[model samples]
Target: MNILMMTNTYLPFVGGVERSVQIFTGEYRRLGHQVLIVAPSSSQQIPSDETGVLRVPAIQHFNGTDFSVPLPIPGILNAALKQFKPDIVHSHHPFIIGDSALRISAQLKIPIVFTFHTFYERYTHYVPGDSKALKKFVIALATGYANLCDFVFAPSLSVAVELRRRGVLSHMEIIPTGIETELFLNGDRRVARKWLGINEDVFVIGCVSRLAPEKNIDFLVLSVKKFLEKRRKVCFLLIGSGPCEDKIKANLKNEIIEGKVIMPGTVTSQPLIDCYHAMDLFVFASKTETQGLVITEAMASGVPVVALRASGVAEVIDDKKNGCIVENESCEDFVSAMNWVQGWGRKNNLKRNAINTASKYTKEICAQKALTVYEGLRRKNHILRNHSESTWETAKRLIKAEMDIIKNMTRATGMAITNK
Candidate 1:
């Protein structure tokens, strides 16, 4: 099987969407299928051994964020498309590369699957002239884009229901971003604590994610700080780095200097596995995550969690079973939830329940489910295009595609206005 995956972001950027692409691509290749990744070219060093990756030109650091704005030149992918002859195109975003996915799918008459990775409306802050209207516009645009695709992948049921509520009528499936279970399962808590120079006796409350504003880092830091102040032997282990680093440093300056707060910028692989195991409880406050991949990763390490009620977090947290899911966004509520989980510790089958939850979302399981869908969809769309397409039909399809996008914009405007 030849699979073409188009995403807005990819490695050497570490985020949920990038990790999802990486995990699925590796799994597909391991299962004896060919996968080609098409993403924006990064200034960072790409792996030298990569073969199936095609990087398009991009503008670096759009809006002071780590994201790259892709510049998709006309006919940039023409030659590769002819060579690869992808059976299906999977899009991980609703804009930029996502547009390319739509164009390519339409041109080649192949199946295109879109993953509703993020609620684009929540991220309008990155764009200049951010407004409620712009947010609503993006929401409608994403809903429209999902409808244009042959299928849609929702990372969680919360997201799936949300998309459906927003009018994404396309065939949809809940395929979560999975974690490598083996890595977390065999992690050495003692070793991780020793490496971080922390004693195993300390109660560590940790979270692993991109430290960005959209992640509600401010609320999380406040909650954790208050939670830690009451306990004499507690540590706040906030992993991952971003724009929020300086703010976190300032807010927890005294605690950090006193060694009560540890911010290890962007720890991955073994260190990340260790950090998860070294923790007594995992904490999250992001209201933006589609799958909350880190939450599951922590769970895989047998670390129960306390997270604010959000799309992905709610699905993963089983409320007093594996972890605590706060219903409101208040700092007090979040802190209280942490205390609640702290009381439970690794008891009352919490750790075992967390492990059970994580087991269901292993990389292998999610990938197999996706691969099965791809196989079925590919078989249904497996047809060779004619050497010469009719000019009228080509014109009609292209014009219609453009019109659909325009209509999406207008529809999104209406949706935004109505909701607002």
Candidate 2:
């Protein structure tokens, strides 16, 4: 099968959606399918070694975010589509490139699938003007357009429910993004700690996320501060970089100076795997994640999670089973939950459960499920088209037979009248 993925962002830019597309496409290729990517060109130069990745010419960066605004040249897109002839087109966003994807699907008469990857309402900070009204409009616009797609998939049930509540009339499915569990499970924690200069005796609580306002990094800092008030042997590692990196660091300056916190920008591959292994617990304070991919990664590494019981986090976390889910974002509640998990660590029950939960969401399982959906949609499309054509052919045959019979009857009646 030939699959075309149209996304707003891709590699060299690290984010949940970008990573998800990469993982899914990789799996599809391993299964003997062809995949093509269409994304905006990055500010940083793309690697020359990369293949099957096409970049649309970017006019400028979209606002100040890492995303770019592409000119969407129809000629280039048409040429690519004509050359590749994708079996189906899957779009990772609902705007920008999404419109181009829809147009291409229509011109080719192929099914288009859209994944509702983010809650646009929560990301109103990126846009200027009346945010509230803009959020409402964005939600309506996204859902309205998604309903027009062949199918819609949400990474979590929370997102699916929200889409439905917001009046998304599309056929929606819940498919969480998968992780490479064994990579995290097998990473060397000792090496990770030694490289980061973290002491072995200290309890490490970490989170991997973009340092942005939407992520609510301040909440994590405040909660960690509350935890450190009584516990002196605890350290925090905040990973990744984003627009609000300087602001978050400034807010946590005292903790940084005291050597109680480390912000190591972004680390990938083996280093990333090792970081997850070095953690005693994973803490997430963000209320905006569609699936909280980091939460699954940490759990896969045998580190339990303590997060706010909001959005998709609730779907993945079972209180005291795999991780602790605080009902609110209050610092006191987060601190209490952390303390409880710290005590619960002695039994190792949470760690076991965390691993178990993560096992259910491996990359292979997720890719297989997604492939099933894609194949099913494609099969249904083929069946419907064939059925329509078969019906039309049968109707034509019947009409022709009826016309011949009428002509024969007319000729016979005229001969009988002449003979009489």
Candidate 3:
């Protein structure tokens, strides 16, 4: 099967969506499928030696954000795609690169699959205006994009229900971006503790995520600080980096200076996995997560998590079972939950249950389930352009694609204004 996957972001930028696309693409190829990824052109962080991937021209770091905006499609795109003859185009975003994916699918007359990875309404602050209307437009825009797709991949059940509420009429599938359970399972606790210069007899509270405002890093930092002050020989293992790094460091300045807080900015690969194994508990406070990817990774490494009761976090966490889920967004509540997990005899049972939960979302199992559906979609597919479409015909198709995308945007705008 020929599968064409398109997204705004890719590897070297450590996040959920990028990791999802990377894992799925690799798994599909291993399963004897031809996969081609159309992504933004190589940035400073991106490597030049990527295979089964097509790079399009893009403006890096748009509006001081981590995202890259794809430029207009070059002529070479049509030529390359014509030869590939993709049966299905899987889109991982809903704007910019997503718009480009929509156009490409329209031009080829193939069915497009869209993954609802994030709640668009929660990310309005990234834009210039960042008004209530802008949030509405973003929501409507994502709903429109989902409706346009032949299938919608909702990362969690909460996301699926939200999509249905926002008027996404397309067929939906609950396929999470699966983790490699073994990769996390094989990490060494002793090795990670030795490298971090921490002793074997210390309680470690850990968090691995991009430190951004939308992620609610400040609240987490404050809550963790309060938790640390009340305990002796307990450490916080903070990983990943972003704009909010300085705030976190300042909030926990005395603890960090005293060697009680270990801040390792953006660790990956074996070291990252090992770090998970070294932790006794994982802490997450992000309200915007579509699916708590890192939560599963920590659980796979035999660590229990205490997190806020958000969309994806609620479903995975069984209170007094695998881990404790805080009922609200208060710092006191979050800290209380953490304290509960820190109790002895409670940690071991939670660790066992956490591993059991993580086992259900492995990369191999989720990939096969998605691929089975893809095979079905391919067999029942239809196309507009044949194997021998002319250059002029392709150009005409592209022009029509532009018009369709523009109309989609307009409809979304109208829905936003009318509150429909």
Candidate 4:
């Protein structure tokens, strides 16, 4: 089957959504299916021999401390859709590129599917107060498009619930963002620690995400500070870069925890897995995530996660089992959870459980489930359209037969009256 994946950003523009699309599309291709990706063009575009990538021209804008938006390339996208002629159009974001895909899907009468990756309502604070109204409006627009789709895929149950709350009672499927299991298994903790110059005795608490306001990096910083107040031998490793890198640095400076904090900006998959391997614990305080792919990545690397009970994160993390979940957004709770993980002293058990949990969310498994949903949607659409067409044909035949009988009756009646 030919599948077209439309996303706002693609390779080289790193994020959870991009990673999810990459993994899913890769798996789709591995299954001997043709896959095409449509995304905003970057400076460096990777070539795909089997899978194709069509980059559309777009304008980029930075919103808050670390968030950016890519406006849609309308004309280029329309032309690409005409040439690609995909069997299915799967969209990641429900705006901009997602909208373009929806429109093209309609024009071509192709089945469209959407994966609700981000909750725009949660990030409304990024926009100005007066513009806040646009948040609900944007959600409404997304819902409109979602209703038109063959199926709407949510990375977590929480996302699916939110879509329902927003009146998107249409077809919704819950699938978690998956991770590459073998990559984490290949990581070497000793080598990773030596590369980062992290001491052997210090307990490493790490966060892998874009350093941005919506991520609540401040909470992680404050919680680490609180943890250091008692445990001075702990190190905090923050991976990934964003607009808030300097601000986070300044904040760490203000707290005078520079020595304890390590910011290695944006490493790729292997190094990131190694960083996770080197860490004793993974601390993620971001409340805005739909699925928190990094949490699963850390878990796959055998690092226990200390995260808030927010959004779809709960679906991946079983509190006190694989990882500890802080019920509230309080820094004190985060610090307490960190201390709990430290005192648990069952590092091996926690790590084992985490690996087991993450194993369940492998890319191949997720892709299979997603493909099942896509196949079901295709079948359903075919059945529905066929039934509608059959009904229309039956109605037309009935009308034509009735008209013929009426004309014969009128002719007979006219002849009888003329003979009389």
Best by lDDT: 1
TM-score of each: 0.95, 0.89, 0.94, 0.86
Lowest summed lDDT window (length 10), candidate 4: 411-420
lDDT of 1 by residue, 77-182 (tens): 9999999988899999888888888888877778899998899888888899999888878988898999999899999999999999988999999999777898
Query: lDDT by residue for model 4 over 1-420, one digit each (tens)?
Result: 788898887777788888988899888888998888887766554555524888667554444333335565647665666676677889887666776676666545568888888877666666676244455555655666576567888888888988898778678888877778988877988888999999888898888988777898888878787786666778888899987889888877745465888898999867877888898889898888999999888888888899988997888888888889899988888888888898874368898999999999899889999988878766765665543346566666445534543443454344434522
Sequence-dependent TM-score of model 3: 0.94
Clashes of 3: 0
Sorted by TM-score (best first), the order is 1, 3, 2, 4
Candidate 3 or 2, higher TM-score: 3
Q: Tell me the alpha-carbon RMSD of every candidate.
A: 2.0, 13.3, 2.3, 12.1
Prediction 4 global C-alpha lDDT = 0.77
- In candidate 1, how many Å is residue 325 off? 1.2
Clashes of 2: 0
Q: Candidate 1 vs. truth: CA RMSD? A: 2.0
| Model 1, total clashes | 0
Assess each prediction's global lDDT (C-alpha) against the native: 0.88, 0.82, 0.86, 0.77
lDDT of 1: 0.88
User: How does candidate 2 score on lDDT?
Assistant: 0.82
Output the number of the TM-score-best candidate. Answer: 1
CA lDDT, candidate 4, residue 100: 67
